[model samples]
Target: MKIPAANRSFFLFLFPLFFVFHGFVRNARFIRVTDCLVLTGAYFLAALILYLLFYALLRNSINAALVASFVMAFYLFFGFIHDPLRKHSIFLHRYSILLPVFLGLTVLLTLYLRKKAPFTRLSLYLNLLFLLSILYDGATLTWQSLQSRSPRFSTVAVFSEGQPACDTCAKPDIYLLVFDEYTGSRTLRDVYHYDNHGLDSFLEAQGFHIQGKSRSNYWFTSFSMASMLNMSYLNGISHPQALTSDDYTNVWEPLRKSEVVNSLIAKGYDIVNLSPFDLPGHPSTVSQPFIATNTKLITYHTLADYLERDFGYVLQRFIPRASKLGNVYKTNETVISRTIQASSLHPARPRFIYMHVALPHSPFLFDSSLHRRSPEATNVDFRLKDYLDYLPYTNLQAKQLITAIKGNSGGKAVILFMSDHGVRAWHDVSDFSYFFNNQNAVYFPDRGYSCLYDSISNVNQFRVVFNKLFRSNLPLLRDSTIFLQDSE
Candidate 1:
């Protein structure tokens, strides 16, 4: 019934290696091939070293390697299971420090028993099952890697380049500002019961045109921005609804080359990107330099790195910090500061500035005057007060930014303000009205464009702007909304 000592030793090492490999597959979009190789190789080398150490420590018992592998596998399994899903009510308070201590003692006890008891038939069967599981995981990873490389268009050009008559006229700088998860006026009044008339009044006073009831082409940020920037729905890509992260990158890589950006470039406009979306190459932070060489399309390099990122949520439960770099408050500050800088700079050449600011969103941390709110909402359910209070702060920041831009441009710039999607999907699950309704407004330099209507959507924002400035006859597309559940 006993298996070879070498066989048992190898099984222990392979089990953890395979578990980590399976995790890497799950987050294949976030991980790189070089990172995968390095992490896997590192773990294998660590296991080999532990195996040799255990061989000498346990009187040449291969079970020593099994003990080391078991501990490593246990830690990986615990992290994978407990980190992400812990936010749900079902997993709340289910884990404790004692749990890990107990697991360690159990592993030591197993090694102690193996020293006295003879290897049994059950042990051999268990080893075989582990081997089969490892092979299955490897197969799954191979299939996912193949799927990631599936064919899709790199770019979808919507407009043909043409010479414009406005070449002789003074070029007006354009601004596309995305205020994340800011609901429409109706939703603000009815659902959230907070009148946004103050902000609407401010925009009107600033010589801006407001679209009262407008929706985005897509519900999410990446998809919605990509559509607006490209001036086309993702219809060019096959099965756009079922796209993975890899598929998203395939379409998103052409953001700079999109018809909208290219048309501006042809008109002698420099593109200024002020979002993490254009990370590594061109993040438009006011003081920070963009380092393109040593960065990633996605920040996560391995499963461990992704899991470590989630530890902030757990840490927030015990330790309360006023504001961290990536927190919503700090992000809003950076967005506002960068926008102010971009506005005041008043660059010599005409510029197309696009800023995606994540505010009036989650981690509702700010009051009307940029003061910190209670950190208790850090782990609690969404509250109407939090969203409403944060709304005024967003309004203040946007107003300040717009005023600066207008002052710098001498009232000669074109500005478009909108949101990716609305809020309250978490509160009112059945009524997706709030989710579809988004905030939209625009400011034309000459006050000459009269075709803009109240029902115009975000998808057509750039289309109208381009038609006005470049004389490109890009027709507006019909607006539609899609509601997707988490399962989708």
Candidate 2:
């Protein structure tokens, strides 16, 4: 069968254009204009080979050159897709991208079998769609880069001369409580449909007004905390990639070393860290341990992730044979178990405690005590029970800290509670919202609890909190956000 001249000419013109467009889109992560040119040249070489094959097709020598040309295209595309050679690989952490390698192989086999016009048409359509998408993406990036601006962190001055006076008469310690992956109370009720009755009531009784819609300026723990502690969003850090790159990503470095602690200490305040995960007792003591708060400098963990350091070698060396060993790495279950139980109180100083509560993150079962009562998966599988069991443990920890502070007869307390982000189930990345995504609010997982991820529901958290903290007539705070009637 003879091929049409129009289709042949179209491939000749389209092939090179596709290469240039694809090259730009794929190499943008490397962002350097030099990487762009280099990838363009590499893509041109591959396209040049395909162009020669297109000529051979016109000359009636298509069969001999089919495999060779397809192989060239496969390699060209796979390099970007697989990212075998790039230093800054986006999908390097994800293995799912390998699924397409097999698809490419299938296409290669089809080309070898015959000049399948239908499949070839489908391929051309895919190429055109891809090229247009890349062009649009390039334009968008250009627009954003032009419009990008810097961020500012304003300093908060301390007020009040006499030590904070309260019913306890010790000191009014401001507790910045962050519940990771939690939404405002109303959203829980409206979206998730679970009745969050106790939390709202307890907060009201505690005299802390909740900010239902208090927004988190940054995503993940470090940046959000950086924004929180610095009292600003991270914009001036023009290199927003720094947040993900683990290069001096600490948003709290300046304040950590600054007089935040010293100011309270000067006023006879002892900085207290409640969560064992963030602050273990002391360096030499056997009671508790904390990761050194030098996150500002040690952006990256430097060494391989603990699992890779220990077993990645075996994985890379043996591939499939090390199946029994598995990818499951150290859970730190031992340190974390004794973590909740271990307590060392420093009653003498003004407390500037930072707790990084660990739960709601994977490998679900924190300990036997913090067990998940819900079924594993399917229609009946809900994390409410797991969260229920875990919440008590967390609440128990919160109560203990409050008790300790009151016991000391401390005066004046300011407590702030927040969550970094919501939990992603089945490796779903939908719960995350970055500036690049053009999304104002983050999305929660598929369990159908909309409150945690909904935009409107998060309004009252800190607003209510500050009201209670500053107002002379502090009223009991009640949360109306928990979804009691229906949470998926």
Which regions of candidate 1 deviate over 4 angstroms? 1-93, 97-157, 160-166, 236-257, 279-326, 368-370
Candidate 2 — which residues are off by over 4 angstroms? Answer: 1-170, 239-252, 273-349, 366-415, 421-488
Deviation in Å, model 1, residue 433 alpha carbon = 3.1
Q: How well is each residue in 156-188 modelled by candidate 1, as lDDT tens digits?
A: 454636545475566888888888889888788
Q: Considering every candidate listed, which one attains the maximal TM-score?
A: 1
Tell me the lDDT of candidate 1.
0.65
lDDT of 2 by residue, 387-474 (tens): 4345554555444554443334332444444565443222322333311111112211121222232232222333232233323222
lDDT of each: 0.65, 0.39
By lDDT, the best candidate is 1
TM-score of every model versus the real structure: 0.72, 0.41
Kindly report the root-mean-square deviation of model 1 from the true structure over all alpha carbons: 6.8
